[model samples]
Target: MQYRRFGKTNLNFSVFSLGTMRCLSSPKNVRQTLIQAVELGINHIETASSYGKSEEYLGEIINSELPVSRSQIHITTKIPPTADADKMRWWIDESLKRLKLDYIDCLGIHGLNTWEHFDFIKQKNGCMQAVEEAMADGRVKHIGFSSHGSLEVIIATINTGLFEFVNLHYYYFFQRNYPAIKLASLKGMGIFIISPADKGGRLYTPPPALKSLCQPFSPLELNYRFLLSDPRISTLSVGPAIPKELEEPLNFADRTEKLTIEEITIFNSLENHRDSVLGTEKCSQCYDCLPCPENINIPEVLRLRNLAIAYDMAEYGKYRYRMFENAGHWFPGMKANRCTECGDCLPRCPEKLDIPKLLEDSHNRLKGKEGRRLWG
Candidate 1:
């Protein structure tokens, strides 16, 4: 496996780190998956306090079933932001107990996906203070945060200069977080790309159109190649559902150092096809159509519409579009059904696109039962 120097923390992290969110389906299956991942040179094992028995499974397997010493593997766990310093410290201690580890290599403030979460962390004697105390006492080594917030919020958090690294969403299909990724890289922070496959437009089971667009490379490999092409990315989290899921990424790791000419050609072709299919209806993501009276994310809604129409990504579009009211701050936005044909956003749009009509059409095309986020 290819390894990168994780920015400020200076840990040598595998390009494809194992995320243990879905690893607790069965103990034997999870044990084998974890062991296989370690055997394949994935030293970074990421879990969370909320991932339901994930830390316990890792604790049961690591140093027992896995062929590695305690010092060889890097264990990362996250705790949600809490205003109370004592509660934050308690969460940290609980994570350590579940993992049976003396020190966590990386401890992240999980789901910093809103200004409220950021405020919670930055409040006097809050979560950050507890994490600092943990660091000083040798219970935690490096500090970071994972976010699913808007670009503005993410950049705001990075500018705090408190975190050594960040875990956020950035994938081939979703490039909205690029600016935040670049800013974090400039800050000398480790950039861990969370859910490159699953949340990355559900590439594991790509739509037929997207699958065809990928050509010689499977959707997963093409997406991996696309992400690994950027040197700023320190690692990509691979949350395997089973042991077999690790094979493809392990094989892809052999060539992650660089993309070939053909792969580059495929990437360009994918972009061209998306643009051509989207035509004039493409949302440029200029944020000009902001401050919707109904609080709908106009650009994001239109972007999902474009994907559903252009790339036969209706299922993926529905999966996300339906998360409007359900995902809370993690995916903060109202559905396009609430557009109300207001003329306010009309004059702001530079593309001269029919905002109300398209939003209504998107609502008709993508609306469904609300979906739950994979995690908060």
Candidate 2:
């Protein structure tokens, strides 16, 4: 396995860190997967309080079943954001107790995905105070945050200089957070990409068109190479449901050398094909079509349309589009179904996109049963 210096924290993280959310299918499965991950040289294990007894199970496995000592592995666990300092401290203590550890290697403020969530943490005598208290008391070695928020919210959080690292969404399919990545790098913060295969357009179950586009490389491998090509990225979370699922990344994690010209060409081909399919109607995500009366995320909705049409990613598109009303601030936007045709965004679009009609098209193509988030 290859390792990178996680900025400011000065810890060396494997390029592929093990994510423990999906491995909770069974106790036997969890034990096998964790053992396999350690044998394969993955030293970082990430879990969250919301991941359904993941911390407890990890404590049991690491304390008894796993062969590695506590000093050989780095454990990262998280607590949800709360305004009360006492509650935040309680959450931290509970995480430590559940993990059967005296100190957490890293403690992330989980799901900092909204302005309100940010405010709750940054408010005087709030969660930040509790986090600092933990650090001062030798309970947490480093502090970071994970976000599924807009660029503005992410950049704002990074600007505070309170975190030593950040976990966020940035992948080949969704390059919208590149600016946030750049800013975090400037701040010397560790950058961890979240759920690259699953949230990254569901590349694990790639469509025929996408598979063809990434010839000679699996879509999963190409996406990994694309993210790792940038030196700024510290690690990518690989969440496997079973031990066998951990094997493929072992082959790809060490190939993080700069992409060859042919590989770069393949990346360009992907964009060109998507643009060619949309022609004049592609969303640049310029946010000019914002300030909608119904609070619809027009660019994101249209971007989903682009993927559904260009890449035959209907299942992935539907899964995300259905999260609009259900995900609260994490996916803060009304669905395209709420478009009142007020003509507010029509004149603002540079592509001259028939905003309402395209929104209706997106709704039709991508709407389905309400989707549930994997973690809260």
Candidate 3:
């Protein structure tokens, strides 16, 4: 596998790193997958304390790979953001014990999904102190954060200069984190993109249109290539559900694959098609038309609609659309059907889109019977 310099941390990270989220089952299976990944040159492994005994499984797996020193593996683990430094340090110690390791290469503040979580980490003697204590004790190396926060909130966290790296959600379709990613790059922070497959338009189960648009390579491979193409991105984390799921990217790396002319043509065609579909109504996602009394997040709804219509990613569109129903604060607010003919947003809309009408049609098209069942 090809290696890249991981920004200011200076770790030689493989462009493809392994995330132990999905295949953290039956120590034997996980061991084989982890070993296979390492043998295939994936030197970096990412896991979390909250990912269902994943650290424990890795503890067993890493030990089994004899002669492989802890230095060679480059392990990273994340804990939830806590206000109490003592509590946070307890988790750090617990993660080391669970992983059966003496030192962790990176410790991340996980799930910084709100401003409160962000501030919690910054408070004097708060979570950062725990990490600093660990560093002083030689138990952890670099510090970072993983977030599902808004673009604005994420930028705020990145600007704080507290982290050496950041774990975030960025893919071909979801460009909301573009600003944060750019800022992190400018700050020389390691940028690790999480959930590039499962949360990334479900490329694992690609629609026919996307599959055709990314020919010669599987949809997942195409997606990987797209992310890897961006030099600013340090690595793409692949959480394969099974061992074989590692093959495509591995083959690409082993063969040192580059985008062929035909593949470039396919990429252009898809871009053109997306532009055509969004003509005169491209959602810049600027949130200019917001604060609907119905409490709807108009931009995200329209973004999901664009995904459904632009890329034929109907299932992805439906899944995200239904999330608003029960997601509470985790998601923004009500669905598009709640737009009660208020002309207040029309004047604010930069695209001057028929907001209510587009929303109703999108609700009709994407919210199918399956979505209703999931929400119920």
Q: Which candidate's TM-score is highest?
A: 2
**TM-scores for candidates 1 onward, in order:** 0.96, 0.97, 0.91
Residue 47, candidate 2: C-alpha displacement in angstroms = 0.4
Error of 2 at 20 (Å): 0.8
Q: What is the per-residue lDDT of model 3 for residues 1-376, given as tens digits with 9 covering 90 to 100?
A: 8887788889989988999999976887788788888888898999999899899989987866734766788999999999999999899999999999999998888878888898897899898898998999899988998987678778999899988999998987788899898999999999999988878888888999878767767777767777787777888888877788898667656433566677677778877888898897767687888778788878888888887888788888888788776754446578888889877789998778888888897888777654443223
Expressed as tens digits, the lDDT of each residue in 1-376 for candidate 2 is: 8899988999999999999999998888889999999889888999999999899999888867877888888999989899999999999999999999999999999999988898997899899999999999999999999998888899999999999999999998888999999999999999999999899888889889889888988888899999988899999999999899888877887887999898999889888999999898788888899879999998888888888888888888998898888788777798998998999988888878899999999999999876566335
Per-residue alpha-carbon lDDT of candidate 1 for residues 136-227, written as tens digits (9 for 90 to 100): 99999999999988888889999999999999998877898989988999999999999988888888888988888888879888888888
Best by lDDT: 2
Candidate 3, clashing residue pairs? none
State candidate 2's TM-score: 0.97
lDDT of 2 at 77: 97
- Lowest-scoring 10 consecutive residues by lDDT in candidate 3? 367-376
